[model samples]
Target: MIASSNWKRNFFTIWTGQAFSQFSSSVLQFAIVWYLTDKTGSAMVLSVAMMMGFLPQGILGLFVGVFIDRYSRKRIMMISDSFIAVASFIMVIAGWMGILSTEVILVVLLLRSIGSAFHNPCLQAVTPQIVPSDQLTRCSGYSQAVESVSQILSPAVAAVLYRSWSLSGIVFLDVIGAFIAVFTLGITVIPELHQDENRGKVQVLREAKEGFQILRSNKGMLGLVLIGSLYTLALMPTSALFPLMSMSYFNGTSMNASIVEVVFSVGLLFGSLLLARWGGTKNRVYTIIGSFLLMSFSLFVSGVLPPSGFYVFVICSWLMGVSGPFYWGAYTPLLQSNFEAKYLGRVLSLASSIRLLSGPIGLAASGVLAEKYGVEKWFLIAGGLVLVAAFLCIMISTVRNCDNR
Candidate 1:
């Protein structure tokens, strides 16, 4: 365990740096989506772009964990950040040359996703190393709050910058952010795990299989992972189509879309703060279940609203945002608490890969459905599926008994 006094300094030092990178990435992501929405209004195109962003992580994440457990996580994070910076710089060059096609954008997303496959799991694995177990949920809440702050600012900044600046200029911010992340990581002192010399001799596939076995041994955690995958299956499509729902369904402008994004993130910030202070309900599983119900209600109501109900839709969006941190805040800490430190990397990575794989499936179906039946209908479908998933969580004894065990 980390010394009580140094834990905050070590965790926050790296976290504050990550916040800068996240803010820049959020800005760039908004710019890319808006650009795609304006250039090609097709739901299929947007879905494809979103798929490219996560598919690599889904495919590679299963194996990435083996290395995270065996190698220096700090080194992996620094290298990953550097790799993403280079990818963003490539986009900057492409934009400057006026050759920034959708294909080019997808390629950048792929490269960035590959980097994130390593960085994200490494970061999660590092958390328990540096922080006390009892404080994990609070730290997760604080982490979410920092991310929400970036989300809150990024959309409005992207909207204004997108209007005044070129794509290359917007992307350059990511390069700078990555540099800062790498620098802070270089200076921070993260305690190293004791490495087993013989462990590296094991085959990667065998190690991955062991990781799977470790996760499978915990029936409740395994069930929770499945529930999360189902939730992502329902959530991703609606999230992918959010811009179209605002512009196409509601007949709104880019500014209006930004307003929706900003308000939703503001709600996230509020919820994160609440979770940080309260540390959630006694049973974290119940906290997650409540979030699911709240989100289902919001999405369902948003779907039923008239075209002139843009304002109401915005409120629903905020409610959806508010529910987000509760689920993630509870969910992450559950994983951290239940698993041993050595196995956390593989467990988190595998779980993330499973959940992410479901997203492309959802996005694919959503594109066809939204393009044919209209985006508003997807809100209804997604809402219904989430409600079902929540009920499943309630019915499953293993999931209900997870935290208690």
Candidate 2:
């Protein structure tokens, strides 16, 4: 019955738009990794691309948070899509002429990352505006489903295209997805974004400062932020290592790497489907804790499991995906529901800033670890650390008591 509701249609349109964009990027993302690996035979190159792609987005998040709150969220997203499309078009052209060196890839990643600085906030801000507070979990769950669907398909397609076509073809397809995103935004009439009434009176610095003030005043939110930040430190290593894991653990095979990634993505899709059907528990903090525990186990399991078998690696990879939605569904809305509407963007951005710092450290560290001790050892070490951190959080009565508020 809920599936036939009007809100479903609107949410579907937005998610569909985001799906295509993610699909294109996912494909392009893997393609870059694959291309770099083949050309340079270096894990560091992949690390650089992955870190640069995330670092800029993280760095600009604070400033962008203020801007997004001040401006139209929908327009910001539309413009971001346009910028991404143009940058992708440039990449396509450059690749066509055989100019896809490491430097070019780095520049492309940098440009797209800058565009994403705006895109991330716009997307998060729009969700609370469109979806009722009661349905936020379902809304987020459905979005993750579509996103996972894209993730499962996009990289596999890119892998095939890389073997058959050239980088130009892959880039062109990516541009198409980006443009489709723009078209979707163009057709959808955006709702008015909510802001605090007192927002007009506050200076920008004070407004930004308000996020910190809220964090300090609200013990629950503050604890959640610190807890989530530590959890991110655990998770980042896996994100950085997926590419290397494929090569090192799977006998240095490209196809094997793709399969591992797709399986993980499908696991994410399966998790989202479950969340959409049942929704998450109202005890959001408990739900989050449960997910983190599962993630810790999955991370641990992945390390010891034989990396050669397709099924075992897939299962391990899926475990990572399964933990994702519960964490995201609980975390994102916690901030939105708890904070003043005027300060949501700034708060979310601050969250973004904290989480993003985990990227470079994780990527660089994991890459180095993999090179020295092997990827399997790296997984075990990282997973063990996650378990310790999660255990610490659960034991802390302060963190355990944090709620949406």
Candidate 3:
């Protein structure tokens, strides 16, 4: 039986806060990416801006998990959200004063990402503390569903608000959303990791090393992280190019790009609901493998199709969306079920960090490649790489047996 009748209450309390946070972030992301694309019309610039946003998360990820494990998860979230809000406030002022430059925008994004570096791992780490073991999958699926809803709304809202609202106006809305997240967080009581007396010295490097050591001991878990990392490397660059693909190749506008984003999120929402209901197959690893393969095929087809295939691209994006929930919902639970609670924050953080770091490498390469060849070709390459990664997971006994672990 589940531990408390109030688990649902607590979970929703935090989830609501997270939902608000994600929605606001998504709105700002669309605003920033579209603004950059509209202003520069250069793939390299987009890639650089994106790299700036994600790089801090990758760099600070190693140490942030240890902080999450040691500190109060609720407090971490509050502080991070506050930090992001403050960054947004600065941007709002800059936008209003007509002093907002590309450099300023990039700096704001970097600050916001550093906050996320701490917030994300803490959020993931606290999940297992609230939900029952068996219900973890359902909760993960529902969480993704909420996130998909946010994504769906963000682009559509941004598309509408883009022409009407000033940059400062949009940023002000984000500030309000952040405060809403903070308020919800304040009301929720999140469980924290307990430190044992006499068992701990204040050694950051040693504790960080211990996080890696936990993964080393669990070969299957380590393999899973590797598989996820490879998958991320393939997917990240392709995604970064989505806006360009719609606008440049398909000769569409911001509204069209937002349409594609909405369709993808709709598909994701449906997929997540399915997971929430079914809780997935008995073998979650197989499900993840299947998800990757499905996404790979869809991406490959997308790239192979011509510019006349904008509709086809939309369909492919939706199919990729369906696969996403199956992959994430199952993957989180697999890790939570397998790893000890004490080490999970570090483990999740390490996995996230490595995956994030790989993205910049792919982005750097894809920026050059996309500028030269085309964005479509990179999609093809990403799909092929993910396909190979799926096969590698199948061949490796440890990763293949991940669900059992």
Candidates in order, TM-scores: namely 0.93, 0.88, 0.92
Model 1, poorest ten-residue lDDT window? 195-204
Minimal lDDT window, size 10, model 3: 193-202
Off by over 4 Å in 2: 1-6, 95-100, 194-206, 243-256, 305-314
Give the better candidate number (2 or 3) by lDDT. 3
Q: What's the CA error at residue 263 for candidate 2, in Å?
A: 2.4
In order, candidate lDDTs are 0.89, 0.76, 0.84
Tens-digit lDDT track of model 3 for 275-363: 99989878788878888999899989988988888999999999989989999998889888888778877888888888888887787
Candidate closest to the true structure, highest TM-score: 1
Which digits, one per residue and each the tens of the lDDT, describe model 1 over residues 262-304?
Answer: 8888999999999999888887999999999999999999899
1 versus 3: better TM-score goes to: 1
* Residue lDDT tens for model 2, 25-89: 88888788888888999867876787788889888886777777777777889899889878877
Model 2, residue 250: distance off in Å is 6.6
**Highest lDDT model number:** 1
| Residue 202 displacement (Å), model 3 | 3.2
Candidates sorted by lDDT, best first: 1, 3, 2
Off by over 4 Å in 3: 36-44, 96-98, 197-201, 247-256, 371-374
